[model samples]
Target: MNAKELHDKTPDQLREELASLKKESFNLRFQQATGQLENAAKIRAARRNAARVKTVLNQKAAAAATDAE
Candidate 1:
């Protein structure tokens, strides 16, 4: 779940990872609302991970655009 790991993945793989992270975040929120979540920090972690995936994806797209020029 580190930037280096994400940086090496293909865009499609990154998208999949982002999707799973978002799903996890949603489930975490649901658990918190029901007062069943053991660790609230997990929600924050998931959110940050999703952001990292998005950042990497954007960087890849930008790089591709630059290379195309």
Candidate 2:
């Protein structure tokens, strides 16, 4: 998913999405280790997607903190 999509989600939803992405990344790694992974590039994509979610989450948190101040 893209940052634009992630940005539209609430923090709780973003967190859930991050959790699923992390799980998928773990599974992808396991498959790679066992030589069952068909596409190595998927690992990279999953990581980047997770990172995007994380970035958006952080940005939201920062904005909230600034507003609170």
Best candidate per TM-score, number?
A: 1
Give per-model TM-scores: 0.99, 0.98
For candidate 1, lDDT tens digit of each residue in 1-69? 799999999999999999999999999999999999999999999999999999999999999999999
Best by lDDT: 1
| Model 2: ten consecutive residues of lowest lDDT | 1-10
Clashing residue pairs in candidate 2 are none
Off by over 4 Å in 2: none
Compute the lDDT for candidate 2: 0.96
- RMSD of candidate 1 to the truth, in angstroms, is 0.3
lDDT (Cα, 0-100) at 59 in candidate 1: 99
Model 1 segments more than 4 A misplaced: none
Model 2, span 13-44: residue lDDT tens: 99999999999999999999999999999999
Q: lDDT for each of the candidates?
A: 0.98, 0.96
